[model samples]
Target chain A: MYYALQILIPLGLLMLGWGVGTLLERAHYRRIHRREDQHHHVPVTTERQLWNPDLPIAESRLVRGQVVVSVDYFKRFLAALRTLFGGEIHSYSSLLDRGRREAILRMREQFPHADVILNLRFETSTISAGGGRAMGTIEVLAYGTGVRYAQALRPPAVPDPAAD
Target chain B: MITTNIETVPGRTILEHYGIVQGSTIRAKHVGRDIAAGLKNLVGGELRGYTELLQEARDEAFSRMVDQAQEMGANAVVNVRFATSSVTSGASEILCYGTAVLVE
Candidate 1:
């Protein structure tokens, strides 16, 4: 029974971690997609100035959003294992992508009415400590100058209830 | 003081610029928060404790940079940037640097 229990326990944990991690990632992506659609009006660009050059800016200021996401144990395990083979650890791709998009979305939410966001920059860093890569945390910070036009260029849309 | 990542603060004229000024701080999570973050790694989600702690540390670094700029007789900080690195187990450094300038 001890042997059976030992095998079953690790297997059970692996299954649980994999299941929950995928589900959480999917849910986060769903929310990201919905919010991306809802926030389509606000154009976030890397350029220093508005594309139109005729918006007549009323105000602009730096807006920033930051988030720290923890890597699930299952992914960390896979990543650690992958290190031996010395190949890509695909498990972390979506996590990094999610962090960037979420941070950008949060920045957009900070100034929803802005005509455009200019000069956007993304800063990302891993917060794994000295012991090993066993513990992983990803931090992404998105910042830009959100510009508000002097005059309304488009009809004001209804507020999104999904926005927080 | 106005702080921006862009080279120049919009709608403001740069009178003079002082070279780059910077501030840094190292923060270590308490035992409780560290344990909490470890448990959170079991599931995939945001680490609220680390988020708040890092942000708090970042703000403190920013404040120190502002203080330095203020002492240099600058009213605004431009081209601001933040970087983080793990210096040791449990302790990480938050560094903020920028150009200090007088703007009108």
Candidate 2:
């Protein structure tokens, strides 16, 4: 009975993690899609220069956002199994996607007055927890210069409805 | 002081270039936060503690880089860039670098 209990406990935890993790990931993806759609007008670019070169810069500031996401036990378990086979571990992809999108959204939220974000870039790192070699959490950071063009340089378009 | 990732700050002229200035820091979370992060991993969500940890590290690196630019008698830093890497199991390094320049 003792041995059976030990097996049952870990199995139960794995199932629970799998179920809850899937639900959470789906919800996060949905939220990311909605936010991306809402902020579609806020052009994000990796180019070091602003979109309109003639536009004079009224204000420019560095804006950054970081998000740390962890993998559920079940996904980690799958990843571990994949490691043995030496194949792409698909389970971790969503974790990175969520982290990146969340970080970008947060950075955009910081600059309510900025018209666009230029030179956008992303940085990712693994944070190991519990002193284990396995990556326990993944951190994604998005940063860029938020630029607000001078009034004379403001683009002649319908003001972004989403803009405050 | 003016700081920008672009080579030149719009509407400003670069009068003198003072070469590159950089700063870096390695940081790790406390044991409590590490344990919390481990538990948080079970359900798979954002670990706020780790996020805060990296943010603090980046801020520190940025300030230190700015300080170096100031010491060089530069009023601005241009072409700024940030890099982050995991140095060890628990520790991560954040580096900020840029060219120090006197601008007007």
Query: Which candidate's DockQ is highest?
Result: 2
For candidate 2, what is the TM-score? 0.89
TM-score of each: 0.85, 0.89
> Where's the lowest-lDDT run of ten residues in candidate 2 chain A?
A151-160
> Stretches of candidate 2 above 4 Å error?
A130-132, A152-164
Residues B1-104 of candidate 1 have per-residue lDDT tens digits of 88777787666679999989999999988878878877778877788898889879988998999999999999988888888887887788989999999987
Q: What share of the true interface contacts does each candidate keep?
A: 0.55, 0.67
Best by TM-score: 2
lDDT by residue for model 1 (A77-149), tens: 7888999999888988888888899899988998898887878998888777446454667899888877777
In order, candidate lDDTs are 0.82, 0.83
